[model samples]
Target: MSNLIYNEMIKMIRKKRLLVITLILIVLIPIFTYAQYKMLQNTIKNVGSSNWRTILQQQIVDQQNRLASSRVPEEYKHLIKLNIQQRQYYLDHNINPNAPGAPTFVRGFVEQGISLFLPLLVIILAADIVSSEHSLGTIKLLLTRPVPRWKILLSKYIALLLNISFVMILTILLCYLISGIIFGYKGWTFPVISGFQSKGEELITDYVHVLPQWKYILMAYGLAWFICIVIGTLSFMVSVLMKNTASSMGVMLAALISGNLLEQVAHSWPALKYSAFTHLRLTDYLAGNTSLIPGMSLPFSLTVLSAWAIVSLVIAFATFTRQDVLT
Candidate 1:
């Protein structure tokens, strides 16, 4: 099993998938870092104060006004109310949610990227893991071996998990390092207020608590990791079902984009709560943000994502083991 996994990892390395992912991050993180920096500067300039408390209070007021407006959609009102509650919690506790530091940037980046950017990277890595074997005619050679087909598929799955872990860690390290250059590498011990829960349009603070910035980042990334793993597993299943790598990628991409679109009508389509894509923003629950679809708690989201991942893995292994490579 170890040998198979090692060989699969070697193939991944040779394919330069990790290198390409790293390159994409390298090219994109700096641009995002600069944008974050500019946004911070603009906020300070417009507010005429560098104090986060003052800025947050102003933001809460603006969001409240937006929430009160009849023009605002109920979907948006829920989000605005949640934002206001979180800010008010910070204000009451005198904690700086957006303290100017790399740790803060890391947390923000993960929250913003979890639903789309990170999943896309996982798709890029897993979309070809299985299909490429068929496309390159290596499945014939692979099956000709005395090893069970299950072991081969298992090895590939293990390799994909490791690669997903690597991509996530690399994403955090790069985001921190690059963003740190502009916003100093401090604030690790800063107090972070979390545990804001949403009950419909109301923000529940009964469980609100403070955590160190470092611990907050760890928890946020941990949720992000789960999301990426679910995405990677589904992509693996798609790669097994499709013979062409491009087709696998296209399918996964379309599914992901459609998930985002579905979020807009999540209330109308209550069944979307059962969808893997709707639960991709697991990190949002950690940050106390309201779901676009009501009735989505952390446990529910985790169960939905886990069910999708387990079902996809079963399908992939069952299909692969029973597949005829000789044809």
Candidate 2:
């Protein structure tokens, strides 16, 4: 089993596509960080640096004004207006609009990278993990190597997990290196205050006390990676069911894109709240907005996601064990 796992890891490491994708992520992180830094610098230059909080407050006000002027439907207009008023109230009291103890630029860049890019990376790597073996006529060869069927699948899954973890660490290191060069690693210990409304309209202000920004980045990264693992497992299940890599990748990507679209439309159709994709976006919970629909709660999202992961794993194992290999 150990040898099988090691071989699978080696195969993944040798894949040119995986290497290229990692390189792309490392390069893109710096480019995005620089662009964001430049934008922030320009804003500071325009608004003056004496009152950074005031500048942030003004920006929130401008956003509110713009949203008010937009041609949104009457139903959502009130929600938008309420959010704008909440922002104004927070700003007026010198409260940081963002959550307290937020990480510095380096840490934030890492977290954003994990949220935005890591899922795609996991999909790219694992989408073909099972399907490609059949596509390349290697599944038969692998099966003949004296390994148990479950062991083989488990090896592939473990290898993929290790590779994903490595990629996440590399992304964080790259973000630190790039952003540290510009931001000089200052403000990492700053407190961040975040507000969330609990059930019964109870406002809860979480004073995330000061910590090294990198520590918070690590926490966010771990959560992000866990979500990606869920995505990867689902894609792996699809790969086991599909005969071709393209079909597997397409199915997963389509599901992701479709879920986001459905989330927008699901606002009207309350029935769409039970979707697996709807729960997959855990970030929505942290963002303090109702996801999938207005009544969908964070605990509900977590339950849905956990159920989906368990079901997908069961399906993958059952299908792989029962299916005929000679096709």
Candidate 3:
């Protein structure tokens, strides 16, 4: 069983399509980091000791003006209220909206990519992992091997997990390697504090105090990978149930895109607060805001995500075991 799993993992890595996808992530992440750095540098150079507090205040004023000029949706009234209250509190207390310390280039880059793009990549890779076998008529040949039905599905699932892990680690490594060359490794010891205000009260939920930025980067990377794995596993389950790669990919993509759309829409509907996609975005929790749905919390999000993962895995196993290899 172990050898079979290992062989499947190797096969996944050797596939040209997977390699190309990995290479794309590896190359694109650094380019994105450079672009972000340039924007930050330009902002600082132009702003000149104005500090983030002033910039935030200006932004608040601009938003207020927009709200007054445009027709604001009734559903977002609460959000507008929250924004106004928070901005006033910040001004009254002389609090800087920007935390004094920022994440390193690698951390920032990975954080940006993971929110939506990385999960899309995971879906693309795993959506066809099993379905492609059916498309190519290899499922019949594979089932004819001496291995038990469950073991083959298990091996493929394990291989998908390992590939996801590899992609995540490689993304982090490449981000660091490329960004270090340009950033001169200055932010490794920077402190990162994330704060959010609610009901006129400031809350600090997660903080990293004076640690190497790389450590923070790794922690964030791990959380991002966890979220991606949940999505990947869900997509893999869909792959097992579907016959064609296109259909598998379509189902997964539709779910993912729809979930994000729902999250945005959920901001308006107070009732849809329990949505799984609303919690799937790990960054929202890390930022210490309530889930997009007003009543949803971090623990609640974790429970919903875990339940989805477990249910999907069970279905995948059962379906694969009973599936007929007609090819």
Among these predictions, the greatest TM-score belongs to: 1
Q: In terms of lDDT, which candidate is strongest? A: 1
lDDT of 1 by residue, 1-327 (tens): 899999999999999999999999999999999999899899989988988888999888888889779999877777887788878888988888888899888999999999999999999999999999989998899898999999999999999999999999999899889989999999889888878887776878899888998998999999999999999999999999999999999999999999977876877899888888888888887787776676888889899999999999999999999987764
Estimate the TM-score of every prediction.
0.96, 0.83, 0.81
Candidate 2 segments exceeding 4 Å error: 45-50, 63-103, 106-116, 198-203, 206-212, 287-292
The clash count for each model shown is 0, 8, 1
Which candidate, 1 or 3, has the higher TM-score?
A: 1
Alpha-carbon shift of residue 82 in model 2 (angstroms) = 6.0
10 residues in a row with least lDDT, candidate 2: 200-209
Tens-place lDDT per residue, model 3, 168-257, is 877766766766676664556554434553542233323412334556566778778888888888998999999999999999888888
Worst 10 residues of 1 by lDDT: 285-294
Predicted structure 1, TM vs. truth: 0.96
Error of 2 at 303 (Å): 1.5
In model 3, what are the clashing residue pairs, if there are any?
188-213
Which candidate, 1 or 3, would have the higher lDDT against the true structure?
A: 1
- Against the true structure, candidate 2 reaches a TM-score of 0.83
